[model samples]
Target: MNAQFDIRSDSTQISFEASDNAQLSRLLDEIARNEALPAPAPENVFVGDGDYRAIGLEYLGHFVHIGGLKPTHRVLDIGCGIGRMAVPLTQFLDPKTGTYEGVDPVNEGIEWCVQNIASAHPNFRFCRLDVAHELYNPGGTMAGDQVALPFAGNSFDFIAMVSVATHLPAKEITAYAREVMRLLAPGGRLFLTAFLVDAEDLSRPTARPRFIKGEEDGTWIADPAAPLGAIGFDNGVVQDILKRSGLDIQRVSFGHWRGIGSTHYQDIIIAVKPE
Candidate 1:
């Protein structure tokens, strides 16, 4: 568990590979430089300063431009890594009647977000949830951040997982589904993406693509029908979990189903809590 940084504690031990050593060092320096020197104040962390912020900013633009969110809509983003998505989205919220809540397991990510999220958006709220899971853990199971979040039932109008649940195995995914439903108000919508193969498809997959060879391998190449422990997924399995969680199927769109298998597929979906 030795990367380069001495980041470890009684409760947890996390480390990056030597490959990431330089990146981590650079991040520390960047924070120090920005913090000490202080630039002229746009203070818009997502766009104002760092390279990583652009990743978050692009997602924010898509959520509004593609996802069709109104500035006044209450938005809750799960697995909101850093302030990339959260920082900019916070700006769109009316902050008085509208609410924007973002959660992530990383302490530093949340700290950066808290310190930089605009003051203009008074209603913007972001919190660290140890119960948050790593976006992509081994076997594609989601890891819960170290702490549980505090929220009452049926509290949100809309919630999104983006690529969050895509990495979760069955149990965690089911657990998260229940939590999301519990937090969603009546008629609220949830947008999530996953690698499930559905019975709705009377036809099997048309093809399966080979794993990207060597260093070029990408997550988009994941084969959902691979195997039990493989990072892939299946619809039959997912549907059972959804039923147990009391969620009815709504709509699903498929992506990444190339290659040569009947089970290779990915989907972005929208679902609602039962009335």
Candidate 2:
């Protein structure tokens, strides 16, 4: 099944066209001067260990140069923890046109973003879902696959799920892909990051997390006792899921996590919904 799809091993430097380069530069300058931008979330409230400001800036560049994000495009950010991605966009997205909607299972992060980020930028909104996750929200009422995201169909121009898939089981991943397909407007783009592994990558000694256990459904995990702690899917499994969800695979940039020389830490998959 994977042989049918063209997944590129991209190792090129991150560069934007002249116009985009200029736009990114302008946005960066604005972000630097904007003293009103919310301060970084406190250590306890921040979800991930990565430097909050640096990762946000880095991925903001990726959204522009790789995801083709425009100032006027509506964006949906899944697993938006403590507004790491939203803080940078407050300077770039047009107040009248571009709007951002972020949803996550962790209540603390969502609350922080609502009070700090959304209070200042009215167009930016955050919602906490009661979705259950073994590592993040174990006592929630809803299963990850069962939650119907609160949004209209074909609503967003750009959707991103950074570091979200790496923590989900296979079924939830499929459910989220289907929802992403439904939420994205026709011709809209999906920028997703995941820990994708092929058989050869599994044999490499330097592959981060080093998935040692295999599930019956072909998903791989770093720890069998805590499957959702760090999950990986076979390259084919991800391709099949996206294809089944009616998304056209545009590109796949392998990440440095697997000892590969790439720009990102997790593999990036860019796809589009056909018009």
Candidate 3:
């Protein structure tokens, strides 16, 4: 199948496109024949580490129990790679009351979800945006900072962007943060994961850390030329951005990226729009 679609722009300059997930469609049909057999291989599920399935399932639990996502809520999943969260969410979301909207600049991932998940669950929809990121969509036409989301204001009750901010520069991150805030309804919750630099790490200024914990500064860029190669922000900066985006920090679970005990490698933050 030719992997391309028509790109449309709206009054707000939001670009939109939806691909026919031909590859995933075939895979899903094949899996349906053998219900007991394990689903498609990990690579087919998503392009990530072997533990992606476990991580995805854990995220589902956190969103529902900790972030207060409910069956009746509308969800907007930014950077929805494949169907990691969407797969588990299929079992949790009420078909009649819940609706899921996932958008990603990577067409392949969105196509997969459109075929494997959206085909069976009409309430779930996948969209493609042309937001450019050096790591993910270098050839994309739209700049990440300038691309307004296709959705209207106050559209979602729950918004999740796992590991999305880690690859974005401060300007781009701020742009996306504000967009998330715009899409969220009053009292809506947001779950975001990113690499956070601590004051202690900044003070020490490790020439080279054991892991990718980042430099002594609160924000670290692995490659100055390629901002998205790997970026880390200080705790203060992260909080200030969230506050300016109209979100109040409900919980912040620092990650072990800095050698601290953590449930996930990347720091997890749960914030909510003011009621």
How many residue pairs clash per model?
A: 22, 0, 1
Q: How far in Å is the alpha carbon of 11 misplaced in model 1?
A: 44
Candidate 1: global Cα-lDDT? Answer: 0.53
lDDT of 1 by residue, 144-235 (tens): 52223467888887787766655555666677777877787777777676655433332445533332211222222244443222233555
Off by over 4 Å in 2: 1-18, 29-36
| Candidate 3 all-Cα RMSD | 11.6
Model 3 Cα lDDT, one tens digit per residue, 134-173: 7788899988888688999999999998878877777787
Off by over 4 Å in 3: 1-40, 44-47, 201-218, 222-227
Task: Let me know the TM-score candidate 1 reaches against the reference structure.
Answer: 0.59
What tens-digit string does per-residue lDDT give for candidate 2 at 1-275?
11111111112112223245764665565565555567654665545677776678789888877887777789999999788898887766767678999999888888888988888788899998889998889999998887679999999999999989888877888899999999999999999988888888977788888887567567788888988777898886776788899999998889988987877888989999999
Residue 36 of model 1: what lDDT? 24
CA lDDT, every model vs. true structure: 0.53, 0.81, 0.71
User: After aligning candidate 2 to the native by TM-score, how far in Å is the CA of 215 from where it should be?
Assistant: 2.7
